[model samples]
Target: MNTSSKQDERIARMTFASVYPHYLAKIEKKGRTEAELHQVIEWLTGFDAPKLQQLIEDKVTFESFFREAIINKNVHLITGVICGYRVEEITNPLTQQVRYLDKLVDELAKGKKMEKILRSSL
Candidate 1:
């Protein structure tokens, strides 16, 4: 598989719940709260705390999470370096969306204000 498809396959089989602990650990290590992480995720995916927890309990994959998500309308305004790639310039749609979430969580861990992290008060 080419790079994009190969990446898709890898992430597609990865479960969101499986990554939850790592996310919590990363932010906690940086002195941030799990609730803030949840807020960032909810903002990006349009999944409330309860629904997010439900999906997590179900062990949904990254592919399934993004597929079922309603990505925010303000997503276009989220532009920044993430894993060395500019979010807006990412060539693959699914990869771009996934990286967007990763970038958001990274920002939260770095203590960026939520207003700026969400890109606006939309």
Candidate 2:
């Protein structure tokens, strides 16, 4: 490989070495076997690790990383010493709940305004 590619490979290797343990911990907690974890790690090491390391070394922020790594893709396999699969299937229900609450507050504010107007008229 070329110099840039070799540097990329080294960064990928280092990143994978750093993140694999965390990934294994998460998967083990979910009752997955070591063999399954290895499979997941292999898949992540295939592409994600190198790309992620490049991004990190490029100093990409967490928000951008999450957006690119998880939001843009339905499935992401992230590996390192912190290996694991990141399924972007989880919804942030709380965001919708907060929006609804905000609308409710607006309606309540309107009601208070009407009450104040009626009281002044009386």
Q: Which candidate is the best by lDDT?
A: 1
Model 2 per-residue lDDT at 104: 24
TM-scores for all candidates: the values are 0.90, 0.27
Alpha carbon deviation, residue 26, candidate 1 (Å): 1.0
- lDDT tens readout by residue for model 2, 33-111: 5455443322322325457457647664333333353221212221111112111221232222222222223323333
Worst 10 residues of 2 by lDDT: 78-87
1-122: candidate 1 lDDT, tens digit per residue: 02367776886788999988988899999999989998999889999999999999999999899999999989998888887778888877777888888889888899999998988854
Prediction-by-prediction clash tally: 0, 12
lDDT for each of the candidates?
Answer: 0.86, 0.34
Candidate 1 error regions (>4 Å): 1-3
